[model samples]
Target: MDDADRIQAASKFLLQSPPGEINDVLNDVRNIISDDDSLQAGVLPALREYNLAQFITADVPGHQHQSIVSDAARVPSGSSDEDDEQSQDRYWDPRSRTSFRFDHLTLETSDPEHVEPDSESEPFRVALENAALAYLASHYHDGVVSVFSTPGSASRFTIQIVANKYNPNNFWSGRWRSEYVVDTGAKQVTGRILLNVHYYEQGNVQLSSTHSLALALPPAIAPGGGAAAATKVLALVEAEEGRYQASLNDTYAEMGEKTFKGLRRALPMTRSKLDWDKVLGYKLGAELTNSKAGFSAA
Candidate 1:
């Protein structure tokens, strides 16, 4: 088969095959590409195309991600640069809708919020994007609970949750409080629930402390979805805590076969519904931390 056909076969195998049987899939592709030099010729181009195809148009609520489907279509199957057919340096980030021209040393990306990758917006949003939000939100939550942190990491990860003042059901909260009862019936809960874990030098060792988030339960939660959503959410958060206290100790992100360890064991001995809070309230230049937490909540 030609390069396109061969690469297509390999990609299909990798995606469709059973999860643990990748070595076998590689072996099958190895035999095909090894025999056909032309097929090999198409590998990099096809791989790039596939890489671009891997992303779908995403429209995240509080944020956005890059996509490449449209640009990939522009390049066509088994093709190169418009100006120079031989140049393989052409690439685009679909999320950013940005094109890169290494040969010309140019970089361009449209605002994800502004441009449409396709004539019509794709129906479904990307799962990974939401997964990332959930992951980061959980991470933000964890960052607050942990005492010892990677140096300089505290500020870098603290992100602001967006506030839509216009929406009657989803407005923003004014004050940041440590008490879990810091809810004000917001139209929407759109901020980080910061648990500003304050570490103070109590002589030979430093004492770690805690903090808060302004939470607002959604309308759904107040009505019927509370229990089901709560179960799912609290589980997610507890999972995150266990992960932070365990694997997060060193920073190699992992999942499955969960375990828990020191500090995490005792700290909030209760399982409050994780869904009770929407996210990390990241305000632009807003301080959520309180005084005596050793850092100025300025």
Candidate 2:
């Protein structure tokens, strides 16, 4: 089409009429983009539809437009949050004996966890739970720990983990769940466990506390490249186990079937070190720990 015809076409769909000069069209183009190229290829596409709609609905025609973003700008500006999000979905898959899968990582407020609870003073407690779960899933690297979070009420949130359930090793067994109450105004979070798992075979074990504890978000660790991330999976798991065993006085969970009351009464805490060889048997192709009460070969 001729320059005159081009101008006419642009004028009609603008949802209003504008001048019919090529220079007029040039001005419209300038309005849509900044004078400089601040955006790269990936970000430009998402902006396309939003930009077109915005241009057509301009309050004043032919005004120089600056880049505009809709609600989805949660990540770094111009970096597709979706790209980061999509990649994380492929995290450790439970079905995969080889690696772990952490799912549905999001920074956007549109996510359910980010939703404002009915009360302004205390929004849904899950608001920060996501951050905790994401940290666990992203940094822990071990597919053994399943990290999940849920919003129960305006002020209630739950973050839980079931570790070493699938792996064929005794490094970690059973589950640990933590619940949090969020007070948006005071910026406080506290939690306790509602359901605890024990290996009746090994004796009832208390992995986490039933009493309320302050919400503690683990500090951010280096998010390395693929290989490094993979390496961390086991390292984090081992470190956690070391902390667990050390906390328990370098003993393993009691073995053999027993009552919950029996477990609490005086069941012996097995005086054993975390046989690194047995606990990490899966990763090392080492010997598995014999099925002892709650701890079993995955």
Candidate 3:
């Protein structure tokens, strides 16, 4: 069958088969596809191209979990020619460097204040914080909780939970309280959440970060955060790609130099040590003799 026919047949088989039976059918189909030279060369590339385009153009959300803070240092203007030249090249100069820091970023739904409270317990408020934390955890790959106070701090982060923020039936509003703490030892700034509540009724709930790093919490609970994790991932991906490209270039250059040296050495009698044909024949005979002796020993 043609490549398209084969693919269609495979797909149909998969659809009809039970999940447990899929592996056997898939194996058979793969064998069939690999046997076809035309399918291997043409159809596979076409399928991959289509898949990649779909992946790249997928309409994912715009928000990210982490963002890199770009810090630009102002270069002082100098009067002398040498100083002016240095000033102009500040960014590129080995001594001059720009520092980039990553912050845990988050995004939340805009506050909705008009919905009436269903009860003093504020079920919607609780639910919203949980949902937001879950979303943040899944998207950003970070452990988050609906915290009322900073883990070790006496101060609480304020959350404004308005009623009917997400749904008409729901009544809760949330605001985030964020704090920046500088760790002198690690030389990093930690953005901590003080308290996250729906703000329907202001009472403090104790919160901690003792859960797994992938904990799902409410976005309202982890207020003032969105996109920080995703931004960090993107930055890492970019840095890794750059490193890989440099290593690849270096490897290619090394390979090329080795190949050139080998070619140079392969040329006819530039050095008078030995003749190539005679040397190769002697080596082959010695290898054959050794092989026969080894076999005889076995």
Candidate 4:
């Protein structure tokens, strides 16, 4: 097909093609165009249309228009001096903003020891649980994690974590434990920590909880060339994983030290004659002993 015909075909494909069909059209046009400049020019309009479709279908309404205007302003122009000035002014114009709010973490544990019958233990346990939740949320925000979750009444969030295969074994291996301290007497404790996945969604405000863990992974990574698009996807994915790892790590650390210390401190004077050095020494020794065993086996 001639350049004009090819452009028209591409435009039509962009307008009516199902997502699965776009790749076929792209491939066909790519094969037909011989010149580098013509091929790039031919694909530009179609790409813009695809981006517009994505923006419109995004969570925020009218995002497509905002994206288009932002993109137009950034296109460096070698036209007249007046045009360059106009482009600069347009780039600075305020566009519609999309707001996001992250909710507190929802705890789900599998440890029966952490579940308590005493009313006094409830608040402390809840506080520890919520603290873990908040830590995870903050981590997600910082890591630029991507998360996808179901949207119906029963939907839950699932976050993805990517790790390099070459990283140290310690990078991927760690036990997470979260516990609530009750009275120092009887050595009683209640709480559970299960090795489970986490999911997060943007713009979701519901505070309810669910029992199931369902996760759907995105089929491809590095799918877009646009800087903004790439950043958003990476951020979402990293944030989700960061939240999970932080929650798990923080909980485990708190349970080992603060929770144990609080319980020890709450004991009766006679029993409170605790040996801090012995307690910490024994804990650290146990961890080292375990690590040695694993290393030896390896």
What is the C-alpha local distance difference test score of each model? 0.32, 0.31, 0.33, 0.35
Best by TM-score: 2
TM-score, candidate number 3: 0.21
Candidate 3 regions with alpha-carbon error over 4 angstroms: 1-224, 263-298
lDDT winner: 4
The window of 10 residues in a row where model 2 has the poorest summed lDDT is 103-112
Give per-model TM-scores. Answer: 0.23, 0.25, 0.21, 0.22
- lDDT per residue, candidate 3, 46-152, as tens digits? 33332221111111123232111111111233546643422332210001112111111111112111322224223323333344455444533322222122223
When 3 and 4 are scored with lDDT, the better candidate is 4
List the lowest-lDDT window of 10 residues for candidate 3: 91-100
Over the stretch 1-298, how does candidate 1's per-residue lDDT look in tens digits? 6766777777666543221233445567777666555544444444434323222122222234422222322322254445443334433333343433322111233222333334221111122223334644654442111001111221111112211111113221111111111111232222223221222234222112222323334444321233343333334344534543564345323222233343354334565534334445533213444333446433
Error of 3 at 56 (Å): 8.4
